[model samples]
Target: MEIFLQQLINGVTLGSIYGLIAIGYTMVFGIIGMVNFAHGDVFMVSTFIALIAFLALTQILGATSLPFCFIAVLIGAMVLTSLWSYMIERLAYRRLRGSFRLAPLISAIGMSIFLSNLVYVLQGPRNKSMPPLFNDVIQVTQGGGYDVTLSVKQILIVAVTALLLAGFWLLVQKTSLGRAQRACEQDSRMAALLGIDVDRTISLTFVIGAALAAVAGVLYMLYYGVVNSSDGFIPGVKAFTAAVLGGIGSLPGAVLGGLLIGLIETFWSAYFSSDYKDVAAFSILAVTLIFMPSGLFGRPDVEKV
Candidate 1:
């Protein structure tokens, strides 16, 4: 039981990071109904940005104040990645937007390849390692006489995820910008007819999605202390699985699905076999789709006869 509790903590913490990346997937899908394949690579790039920025600040320049340095690196990564996303939408995706659906799909795939290799060329193919940050642990002992362990980093991940999610929810639900976004999601043509800037909205969507992905990238790097040029693909796929399991286009569903996937992966590794954890997450995705295709919080297709 104690072990279970400990794994639970780990799962939630990992899930929070997944949830952050999943938001990027779900948001872009909600607005445009297309998967952004390069998004995962975009996340990888963000991590690199954070790594370089952190290294320059702490190692090269000899700066103190860990919190401030982390914040600066995180923000810098988010901004750079957000620019990358915007350009992707503009230069690669925008021109192909209304064309054959396959055009954008292929473009995204090509972009993914391009970005991954770009990182490979720039940063080399080796895994980049960092000194551990936020290594403090908090221990808990239940009445059953088992000890459960928690870390400050884990707590930071959960808290930051919660806060960001709350702010994002408010932006999507309460703001005028949110209304414009929902309008475009329903029908881009109609939204444009109603005087909304459809293109700008889509661009903003990309920016926001990339920003969230950037945050996930930084958090994951901090937690693991190691990153590679090709590291984005697996987590990206898992996050996509999470987006699907939670129901694409639904914000809260993404978080819920992320947490569930995290728990399943963690518990499977702990009690069953570490080797099959990824397989378990994929299986859950398949089972969930078979049972409920629209996702837990997604709306059903309304066909007009």
Candidate 2:
């Protein structure tokens, strides 16, 4: 039970990160009805940007305060990643719009390859390590030769996830921009006919999705203390799995799915075999997809002929 609790705590922290990235996947798919094959690469790029920002803050400017350095890196990465996201939409995706669906998908996959290789070329296919932040751990309980511990980083992850989720819900649910996005999601042609600016809404969607991915990237780097050019694929796929499992078009469902995937991976690693943890997650994803294609919160779309 102690180990269970410990794994649960760790799972929630990891799940929060997955939830952050999964929200990006869900948001993009919800609005555009396309799986962003390059979304994960965008996340990888943001992490590199965050790493560089941290170096600039700590090494160049001698920022010794962990909190200040973290804040600056997070904000800097968010801004730059949003710009990257915007450029991607404009350069790679915008022209493909209104074309055959496969055209955009192929473009997204090509962009993903381009980004991974671009980073590999620039940063040289090596793992970049950052100074560890939030090393403090508190033992919540001591039991039969096993101790349950909670780290400061875990607290920060959970808290930040909660805050971001709340802020985003407000943004999507209560704002005029959100209404416009919703309208576009429902019907882009009608949205444009109603003067909602479909193109701008799509761009904003990409920007917002990238900003969220930036947050996930920063937090992921902080948690792991190391990153590589190829770091985006697994997490990105897992996040997509989370989006699909929870209902690709549902925000709340994405969060739920992330949490479940995290828990499943952690518990399987703790109780069973670590090597098969990913297999378990993938198996669940496959099973869910086969059995419940619409997902828990997703509804099928039926268009009139």
TM-scores, one per candidate: 0.95, 0.97
Tens digits of per-residue lDDT for model 1, 110-201? 99989999999999989999999999988777566677988899898888888888988899889999899989988989999999999999
101, model 1: CA deviation in Å? 2.5
Model 1 regions more than 4 Å off: 142-146, 303-305
Would you list the C-alpha lDDT of every candidate in the order shown?
Answer: 0.89, 0.90
Cα lDDT of model 2 by residue, 53-111, tens digit:
99988889999998888788888998999999999999998988879879888999999
State the local distance difference test value for candidate 1. 0.89
Best by lDDT: 2
Candidates in order: C-alpha RMSD to true structure: 1.6, 1.2
lDDT, candidate 2, at 294: 76
